[model samples]
Target chain A: MLYLSTISWLQEGPFALYRWNSLKEDLPLFFHAFLYTIGISLGALALAFVLGIFFGILSATKNKGAVFLSRIYVEFFQNTPLLIQIFFIYYGLPLINIVLPVYLIGILCVGIYHGAYIAEVVRSGIGSVPRGQSEAAASQGFSYWETMFYVVLPQAWRMMLPPLTNQLVNLIKNTSTIAIISGADIMFTANSWSSMNLNYVPAFAFAGILYFILCFPLAKWARHMEEKNKKAYSR
Target chain B: MIQMEGVNKYFGDHHVLKNISLTIEEGEKVVIIGPSGSGKSTLIRCINGLETITDGLITIQDIDVTKKEAPIRNIREKVAMVFQNFNLYAHKTILENLTLAPIKVKGIKKAEAEKTGMEYLERVGLADKAAAYPAQLSGGQQQRVAIARALNMHPEVILFDEPTSALDPEMIQEVLDVMIDLSKINITMIVVTHEMGFARTVADKVIFMDDGAIVETGTPEHFFTSTENQRAKDFLSKIIHH
Candidate 1:
């Protein structure tokens, strides 16, 4: 049905593929909106990476309390919807006198929400390392933290990159959720164009194409790394 | 010097080491031989506090192993271990593997650590592979590097837990040769191995274990030739003739 809509839409004059000529003028505006989207996503990703690694290592440690606490955080964020999280932080917080800017709210919502997923990535990555690696370090008189930082994490980090990149792609795509709250991201800009031009098909399709342009290289690089790492570790 | 008096270890309901009592003096080379699952590895692992004893007194140079608050790190610094699988850091170069413990644990400066590390690597005849990662080296070379890693710490004693058992048969000789060189240096050592020849050559004492208890302890000649214990005699004949 979606394919039929795509095929039949080309028959209309102004709604046709040739409409790109008229929309070419909006490219500069789209570019700015793209930058805004990237900026929000990058900020969120940076926040997520730091918090994710912190929570990840905490969850991976031997301390039962730390693991339990991190598990609570992960389960809470992951089980809830991203839209509700953004609304809770952006709108719901103001009822109690916490009034953060919309951009900060967007970044924090995406960052922390995705941070939970990244924590799982970190936990599994560290767990994949053989127990012998850390045991060797411990037998060498390295303290627990020293063994983790020097021996286990480096090897785990290599195994983590492909999956972590996957998280990065997901985090970037999730930035579009900000539009639901009326924040000025790429999707919001696309909505404005579709509303003015009444060309929902072409405008949204263009939006998806732009998202592809943004995300394809990262996806491709992740695949390449997975293959390269497989070969490197096979020996 | 090492002492284990009435030592016992259990893994869940399975008793792994039972009523163990032994003393190892400084500079003694003790070789433990047993069939697989006889708890030889678990016995040596207890000395460095790698595996906690369920009940007993294990003191190394007056440091008690059974005490929870006692500085286990200090004991580990004095006692080094070489594993069956080498267990060298796969991400680190050979030199880095050797130097990590000294630098991180002992607070040795980088230049001196590298110098000490290189000296031991050269002693193991792998100075040329200092910059190479562990996975890049042959199994024999990796085991040699593991020995060098243990030796660079200048440990008071070293533990070998089936160190050469994981190597290819031909590769075993290279690691065993490095170990033989190690014995002549007066470092206290405990070795658990299947290679009866290594036991025959360098051990000051040979201990045979069965069912988590020491079956016999003797000098190399007495342990190998004059053993009257049926278990020891049966074990020796099996490995020697095989």
Candidate 2:
């Protein structure tokens, strides 16, 4: 089990410190790799938020074509393995004569690929609103978009924040998939350490802990907000 | 002013409302009572376009509601509806729930809307609970807030759908009291409720519906005691006995 391996790594940590601590070289590489992972993850998330919200709202609207396109978009990304998706963009973009810059492509592909799932999360957030809110606003003589923006969406956004944040944390964790595609993210650095030290246990476990450090606070805060909003908005 | 001429509504030919025709004068108080699934709710909902009529022209304050281009939103803005569930914006404080429509729809200033909101909240005896969320209030109190929400629109007409059906027996009286007071105002109203006592006290015209058809319409005293329609008499007897 992975638990036993982590324990073995814990037993071997002082050995790793004795072996590499004086070199001080692995420390900078670890921090640099962590920054690259966060940077790419955040960049992709920003893009995902925009595209997710844009198509999410569009897909939910009265337009039939928009709904279909957004539906296809959601299913395509969500049903496919994200690792395969990263590989496709990394390897396939070149076939189209689109030489995507290595790091930029990672961010772009991850953002767009995850954006499909994020869109559904966004759509559900919007859908959770009662029909009466829209009807009530409409009855007040506001236009459809106006009603959505001012009344429906305000309430929807409050509800959607938690789920959207969850997507963000997952997106960060998913950045590890980039290692499969030569994206030079934090996981790749850890892999290099594994190869160099012949210590897969310490390397992968440290990688997981590093991701946890980045993701735990965010996930915790999201859950906290969800509970707080539930109380605040309870009928 | 409101008019429904030959209104025909159906849910996949279930015949929910058939050839419903009526006229509501300004400042009139009309109460509709009937057994379940009798279309009383549908009748009132049609007035507000909450339920679409298959065939008919419904005119409210001279606006033809059946016409899509004639501005249903405009009609609705003038005719506020207080639902049986007390659909207060659950996320908002009582004051925010009251003021949102006024500020957004009427382009009223926040201070002006809040002042109006507070006045209605005061009338409903929840002025002190302005900052309180709808969940914090009792069912009767929430319904009262719903009334205040509707009234703040300064509507020409208001619709009530089974206003007291959800309340506890002890809590029903407070909501009914607010409605009784509403009856004294000039706003036209069409209430769909099973509350026979409320009908007896405040309704100028009491309409009885059965199986999607109007069985009888009359003054409360006449309609209650001396109805010729067997269904109406039966209904009165059953409800009174209960």
In order, what lDDT does every prediction score?
0.89, 0.84
For model 2 the TM-score comes to 0.84
Residue B80 lDDT, candidate 1, scale 0-100: 95
Q: On residues B133-185, what C-alpha lDDT tens digit does candidate 1 reach at each position?
A: 88888999999999999998889999999998888889999999999998999
Per-residue accuracy of model 1 over A1-235 as CA lDDT, tens digit each: 7546867667565577656755687788788888988999899999998888889989988899999999999999999999999988887899999998778888999999999999999889899999889989999999877887899888898789988988899998999999888777889888987798876766788889878888999999988887877656324
Q: For residue A108, give model 1's deviation from the true position in Å.
A: 2.2
How does residue A64 of candidate 2 score in lDDT?
Answer: 96
lDDT of 2 by residue, A19-92 (tens): 44432456777788899999999899889988898878877787999899999888888888887877787788
Each candidate's chain A: what TM-score?
0.88, 0.84
Give candidate 1's error at residue B204 in angstroms.
Answer: 1.8
TM-score of chain A of 1: 0.88
Position B158, candidate 1: lDDT:
93
Q: Write the per-residue lDDT of candidate 2 for residues B42-134, one digit (tens) a residue.
A: 898888787788998899877899886877767778889888778777678899988888888778899999999899999988899898888
